[model samples]
Target: MARPLLSAHAERRTSVDYPYSETMYASVHHERRAAFGAELYGALGIGSGDHTARAVYDAESLRFYGAPHAAFLFVQGDGEARLAADVGAYMQTLLLAMTAYGVDSCPQGLLSFYADTVRAELGVTGGRLLVGISFGYADASSPVNQVKTERAPLESTTAFHDQGPSSESVRP
Candidate 1:
């Protein structure tokens, strides 16, 4: 039932404006709950009965103020070493996907600590906790989002060798 419901929600990615009000939040929460309710750990294969381990879990246990729009628990299966880099790459993919849908996201790595709780909850072994992603529509009015930081000039940021074998042939 939950799987079907989540699938339905994921399928409904048409033009819809989800305001930052409680009502819209409730709707998103319901879909999230439908997709990841009590059976969350179980669905991910680390329930109470089973002894299977995981690398990620819920953020609610952290006891923060406002709830995230949605949380996705990711485990480091097989490729634990490259998890962080892989995650960053995937996040950029998510950003592109969201952009197409008129939505925005802020891929965060700051939650790696809280992900510890997720590991503890899942009783995972070997692999370490990676990070958690908070996905939602960007608040346009947010000054943080609106402010675009500039980068150093390409020459300062990039390193390159002489274009030719002769020192006089290239300009540094």
Candidate 2:
């Protein structure tokens, strides 16, 4: 069965109105979102108006990416700015460590929607469910694994002072 993502209860349970999210979507975050969306849909060969094909592709992709393991990122604090900042820092550190160990990872906010299910499965009593990461050794043969998204230049997203040498835009 093809499951739709926006059931009525799902909207109530998962949708959150973050204050800065509006500003993000409206301005500073717009370019990267557009670029990423373009790359993603291009990779899937789905045109803008091809909603049916897009839906089928999304459903199939969910099942296709059945990675062996997923790790949830959680915090013992409420959804406060400081706590979310800490979570971001921790996730970055963890992802760096995983890369050093040759493990592939995909951080997922989608998993957090089913927070109740996660808490039940993991016997978690406290802490807010923040996000999850799916990881495994890379399967280089897979086209999905080969897909890459465009990132904004470092200078566009970062600010520098009279600190060190000339800041060069990092490219991957």
What does candidate 1's lDDT look like per residue over 101-123, in tens digits? Answer: 97655443434444434444456
Cand. 1 TM to true fold: 0.42
Local lDDT at 45 for model 2? 79
TM-score of each: 0.42, 0.73
lDDT of 1 at 65: 12
Question: For each candidate, what is the lDDT?
Answer: 0.46, 0.66
lDDT of 2 by residue, 31-124 (tens): 6677776677777677878988867565442232566777877777565778878988999999999999998888866666656666666788
